[model samples]
Target: MDRRDYLARLAGVAGVGLAGCVTLPGSRVTGDDLPSVRNATTSNTSSPRPDGRLPRRGEVTLPVSRREMRSPLTRDHIPAIVDPVFGDDWDGLSLPDDSRAESTTLPGDAPVIGLTDGDRARAYPLRILDWHEIVNDTFGGPIAVTYCVLCGSSVVVDRVVGGSTTTFGVSGYLWRSDLVLYDRATESLWSQLLATAINGPLTGTELTIRPSSLTTWGAWSAEHPETDVLLPPPQSNTIRGREATFDYFIPKYRRDSPSVIGFGTDSNGLHPRSLVLGVAHGDAARAYPFETIRREGVVDDDVGGLPVVVTVAPGNTLVAYERRVERQTLHFSADGPSRLSAGATRWQRSTGAGVSGPQATHDLTRANDHPPMFWLGWSGFYPETSVYGEDAN
Candidate 1:
């Protein structure tokens, strides 16, 4: 079907009467409902198994029935959509040379998922991810880099599960408005936000979270010139076309949208759509609202009884690090020539490495697992989370 016809049909399905405005079934619509619109375009590019059929549900042996599987969301509410993007496993994945990348193609403000391991770094632009939500690739090691445009969640996880390295694919399912990933090895379904297998043989298994950053393409490319950026696989021109056609439909899911899923209420009174850097240390979880941090620049806080510092660097990159160095709790501030300071120590915001001071050789431990996500998704997953601000709920 043509793009216009398909979009009209999709709008009809969602009861959207206006051209640019999309309204869902509920009285209130948030970013969660925005990705659902991709369901129509997704079917056009969804990858099939090598045998030319959709992978059978429960293809892997499981102790429990598929229908009996449960997660934070109702199993019945989980819609079985078409993969539409990265079908099967690692389909359309690519490694493009950063030096060779055409900077003119990506806008400076365009979002990109940044990942680094030692000297190896890469940036996956959202323009590509808007079509394929998952990229199973190796850079210094096996890793699955994922971005759920629906939930505004970007995470990079170790591909190895239970000592066995496996690739992942989009399962064409959404749990609590988050992407559901399936391992090609066991066909086990996993939640992208929770980073845990929710069904199939590997149920309850957790994937190791890796340190990554979500920032603009210009900022990331400037920081790591040698980093390889993912480009659309030549075979997926159709997917790329669909992304362009639907570009206008994205703002409805932007930070201003009223659409939200799960616990829509923000106990801290922060806007449900506000962006925040969510930190979960042990049982303690807190959200550092970007609005406040953008104003203050740096925040010194504690999570799970461990002193920590959250810094917002130039280009709006957000990172959190443990403040304890050799068992000494050091206070930090952004008011310095280096932009970060703990006493006489100068620190680099990108690597959390001390540049100069008595602790010049020390590296601040990073709380990499903390996801910088939308307030709606973060609070939904962590209902009891505290907001880091004077007006916190």
Candidate 2:
């Protein structure tokens, strides 16, 4: 079945009686239409002056030459969500469970990217994201929740530029099989994986990645029962006449045998399609594969010379955090799958919050997983990254 049909099938799993999915009307350009789009271009005159606003075009630096970028679709082929609407009662809606159940995949089991701001949990369903790649959300300050279905990359970033908040949109461009996003205000082209502007006026500027969890909606909402979910626009907006489908892409091809639009191969045996939680710190970056973490339960390791800990829940919700507390490095182990225990202190797996012990008020500094991104997506940008099981595997 096509992607839209797939989304519609999985969204049926939600137990709610009703409520949303936003899908843009435009369709991806066929291979034949690729030639119609222009190659990316830029004119660099001086060193990049990193700041909060877009500098004039031709007055700064570019980390990559324009030759590496190509426009596959015109702007808004998959539009960005500028004014996102949320519903607190979506969980209460009666979702199609047994009646329209999927024959292959589990119903309502699609991955939902979860984030909490000001103690309010929100879910951005991938079904909607497959159509609109960027959501410029203003939950707490300004942030952009982005997903590139091709690369299996979801990036939540601080959308503040040069002290002012801005929104982002899909550029309909592709680089290294990843999404290229452009800020609506300045029109600077940003790479979703690199989180850096590759062209336009704001080249070389990097976005601050925020913390989020990529997991099944059942798992996320079960933990955050009060979570608000993004609702899709009316069916009339979908140009393809595709119904309001919800859910994420299920990996079809193998990383061992690469596809035309995927990472070719890895001599290290890391498959491009492998699901992993990746962390980049200091001068080092590493990927913690789901298989390894699911088996080990808790992994205490060091990256970039700093101590780190990784925890995974039974539902595949994962979180990473700095293992040091006030300069003291503590080795962490599993207190079951969803909690961490290190001597007298304990932390919730979904969050680094100290739930029990004298440090209950202290919060562990959140570490990066890049939202359980795929191996091909993470490794493409961090080619020198180390694998967590290099020594064990």
Q: How many pairs collide in each candidate, listed in order?
A: 6, 17
Write candidate 2's Cα lDDT for 352-380 as tens digits.
Answer: 87889866567888778477876756766
Kindly report which residue stretches of model 1 are placed more than 4 angstroms away from their true locations once superposed.
1-104, 235-267, 336-338, 390-393
lDDT of 1 by residue, 1-393 (tens): 432333234323222211112222232334343333332221112244677664332223222233332122222121211122323222234333323333335566767788787886777766656545677777766888787655578888888998988877766555545667788788777878777776666765778888788887677778777776664444233312322222211222443565433323333546545778888877888888887887787788899997889878655767888889989998988855226788888888866877888987988888647557776567556766777884642
User: The CA-based lDDT of model 2 is what?
Assistant: 0.67
What residue pairs are clashing in model 1? 29-258, 29-259, 30-259, 30-260, 42-84, 268-393
Clashes of 2: 17
Instruction: Provide the RMSD of all predictions against the true structure, rounded to 1 decimal.
Output: 11.7, 9.1
For model 2, what is the alpha-carbon lDDT of residue 46? 34
How much is 245 displaced in model 2, in angstroms? Answer: 9.5
